[model samples]
Target: MNQNYSKKCAPRRLMTVTALAAFLFAPASASLFAQAGAAASANSPAADSARSAARAADPLRGTPSTITSAGNEARTQQDAFERSHRLGLRFYNGGADATCEVALGRICYWNNNGDVPPPAERADARLEREALLEVLAKAQRENPKDDWVNGMRVRYAIEGGQAEVGLEAARACGGTDWWCAALQGLALHNLNRHVDASAAFGRALAAMPEAQRCAWDDLTLWLDPAMHANYKALGCSGRGAENARVFRLGQPLWMLPGNDLQNEWYSRFTMSRVHSLGRLPYDMQWGDDLLESQLRYGWPTAWSVQNGGAADPRPPQVVGHEPTPSYDFMAVPSGIGSPTQATAKDWEPTRKKARMRYSTRYAAGYGALPHQFARFLRGGDTTILAGGYRLMRDLEMGRAPYTAALTLDGFDGRAPLQVVRDSAPANSALLVPFSSTMLASVEVLAPVGKRAARVRNTVSPLPRETRLSDYLLLQRGDPSPTPTLERNATQAYGSTEIEGGTTIGIYWEMYRQASPSAPLQVSLRATRLGASFFQRLGSSIGLSKALTPVSIKYNDNGRPDGGAGRSLTLNFPSVPSGDYQLTLMVSGAGVTDSTTQVVRVNSGNK
Candidate 1:
């Protein structure tokens, strides 16, 4: 769970090749949330006098001698780059005769890339699926000189619905089968398919052979460690080992290793011990680096295609107040053609130049609040003020606090999902008014009674635009057979509603996708609002970041630049008097969004 994600509470780069320093750690079954480890050594006092003179010249006093001469010069340049790119072992040519016709195991290209026909409603009373469809119809009537088990019996006769009997059984079974023409172009893309699954994954990537086109994109990222060692060496325990650990946690070489760990060295020794192995058996499969570089750098995290416009849409309600409880998937609406009418003089300056181009991509992902504000709640307490929570747990155990977490589930009604605090006395939650910009205030809390709670706020985003994969997507994970491709900028919840005296407000316009590959989650919800003319426009303006609590009952005690002020009074008689709620949860490096509001105590009350 430590792939060093930065970009906000970010900065991690430790990779000492030789003298060994690959500690990593973060995949131990997703480390049960709440994390902020590995990051406390900022050369203080010259690194405590160089670790007290390398611990008095070492006797293994925590291994020293200038850190073992910089880990033997990084293990002699990682053994001269693995002895100049070694490359010896290479066999599995016919892929163990296509894993002895699947009854055995090994040749795994995303799971047997073939064989699956006997289903026309179990073709008349199945007796072991009609003797395994009479041994796959006598291996397609003996057309087998084994070109990878007759290219898995022509991809199980074009996925069974037989595209012209799998192109007449691959033209009466051909010889140089490149998986029988990628199973007759994937049995004509399983019937209702697209120009044949794109001409069968593009003629299986043009029958490879152009020096194996980067070995078939490194064998499509070794489709999860050779399909979890050929489904546990074919015993297939009814698809066991927890279904090969969900196809090796959805493969991609668990985010950037290579040659599928030297052609399977026990799946790179189980991805070097899956972050110190934990999590009872699964959950976390190697931690962050944009999900282990999308499984060993194969990249492309997810894609489903076929978007004939609108299907699973409704989701686009971002504007203010969100203390959790949101999921809007861009709120649908793309019906495509027919609906033109412009011409009110070219639609009023093209709707003001498309509202200044979506407000400059929403102010390039938002600003304000860059460190200096802490008071966490919802279980593990942490408090800091104007540099609070003990300087934010000394920047979460030294440099890096925005750890990350926010989950809200399905609601029941009166909306306004709760978790608000700072009942006045200065715990500000968005006030802004003073004019020419810059008077910001945002506070969302939960503490005092904590009703059926499930909120996790680990702030830190003002640190010069946040990155390093947004601090390795906030650590905690493990269990590995290599396969990683995560993208959840943080915002997970399911059941909702938990009110408190309410008051809400928000104004955001952020965006950043100039080729963003992942990282985005912005959720915000809020209700309870009587506005009170926004407290008479925060006393006719002087917006000193809000907090005026004590005791003023003012129809006129006068201060907020007095000029045109009346009825408002709050001056901190030690502040904390009643009803509350506030929410905001923005994310990047997995993109996320959120907003919510509420706050009370007004009849000139204190």
Candidate 2:
């Protein structure tokens, strides 16, 4: 128990702080899904009245079940109300037309709740027709160059099989243009056109502005958890990317030199490219917790569209997940046993040491410290954690006689300290520092007995040439297991054979060692032609499916490893009877490399 430092806050101050916290770092709720089955309860007048009131307050939104018990009841209710309104605005007001907005809003609301309006009343259905048209018309009349508007128009055309119209619109709208370019890309894609679509999408990426990008970045970081989740649930990966393009419009943006964009940015960096970081459909506890904390306490103003919004305005959110070079020394203890070491795993120790990969990153800091620190982390001598989070406490360098206790909050509903390590007279193990202002640390129980393992620094200080894998992973979610086909490593990119209609599956991991958080993007395509050709063709054809787009965002508090790890799945329908090839890309923050596998398909299966 610590002393209360601040004066007692007024209800409004408390509300604002609580709201801010919810906005910055609220966790996603499993109960959100359960609400779907819990409709307005028309059978009860009181329940019906509550539902009607909710609808009036926010035409399309649902209440998140994950409420903080620590806060006052009024505060909690107020936070919930504000969050619901924000969701309504994000889904219903932020898009092309009322219908699309509402439909998306419905999806968002339903994501946490089971009840959804019928098809006729579905906002998505209406948006698919009228609202999209309105947006297109508005773009054409007022801001034809606006990429977002044009992009939607183009997409509607492609989906409606109006390939010619789509191409014209795309041609008229440059990639640097906002939604317009997205629309053109989508339209071109529908007509079995890949090259044009790729170019369109490329232009969109290239034309993006740094300032707009900055704003969008803010939105992703600060937007409410419920709102963010609803946005992702709308199958809006490409849309979000396209939106990001809108933000980055008019900026001399450059993607990794290779044909891949999704993989390059999202995967290499392990930052979520599609979904908002710390949003839903992601179940990891730490990520959720950290996100909640960020929402409540981090620099959310930075994430606001109006302000220099980023997830936080505070100094770079410290990564507590893993170890880095900033600290004098960091230690990570892992019990590596063979696949089936049976019960005698840790004890049946052979001399074989488990080779662990630590992901590392440096926050953009001014002066000599941050940059020098980055250099230090990359110097190949600094040891980092698996997903680049915590800096291990260096028992070797730090003064001894210090103890650290790990405390987990949610499970027991009490702040119980877990593991405590004490250093000898002159030295102590590594101490993990909390760095991210956007995320908070939930003290975890430190393991006992096992000597704190030394983190081996392996980053090479190589010249910064265009590393394809690195760039790709930076663009998308965390990469797959293996990167390029290095002769030394046993795992190499593989090949698969498929019939025309046969489905192919893709897999990968999203790891962030620091805050139990990592955002990711997953995409799969086949290059019957060369990579470039397929990319272009895919873009032109508007064949990219949002459902198939793989992107997982990291969270703050549950798992130290940013528990964004998962096996992504991609399925392809029957293609034309020709020799076809496939490419799958995954990316995220704190991820170093991406893995690719090629597969061939024949027409007989179709």
- Candidate 2 lDDT, 1-606, residue by residue in tens: 011000100011011222222212111222211122233232358965874665435311213332122212323333343233223221111111111101111111001011121111234433444444444545544544443334444544543446687677666663344444444554544443445656655655555566544433333322224345544554523345433422221011111011222212221111111112222222221233333222212211101011112543322111111111111111111111111111111221111121111111111100110000011112233211111112124322223332232211121123222233343211111212221111111111122221222111112222223122211111112245333212111111112434454433332333333332443444444545433555555556776422122233333232333333333234456654444434445444644334443444456532
Model 1, range 1-606, lDDT digits (tens) per residue? Answer: 011110100111122233222333221122322212322442247766875675455331123322233333332433332222111111111112222111101000111112221112222222322333345445445533333333333433432334565556555544444445554444443343334434544554466455443333332222333344543454422433332322222211111212122222122212222222211111222233322322332211111111112442321110101011111111001100100111112112112111101101001111111122221111122111121111121111222212111111111122212222223221112111111111112222222211111111223223223221111111112122221212110110111211122221122223233222442444332222333566537744845213333111111122223221111111223223343333445565555444333434333333
lDDT, candidate 2, equals 0.28
How do the predictions measure up, each by TM-score?
0.20, 0.21
User: Candidate 2: misplaced stretches above 4 Å?
Assistant: 1-152, 155-168, 174-198, 213-606
Error of 2 at 354 (Å): 28
Measured by TM-score, the strongest candidate is 2
Shift in Å, residue 99, candidate 2: 25
- Which 10-residue window in model 1 sums to the lowest lDDT? 330-339
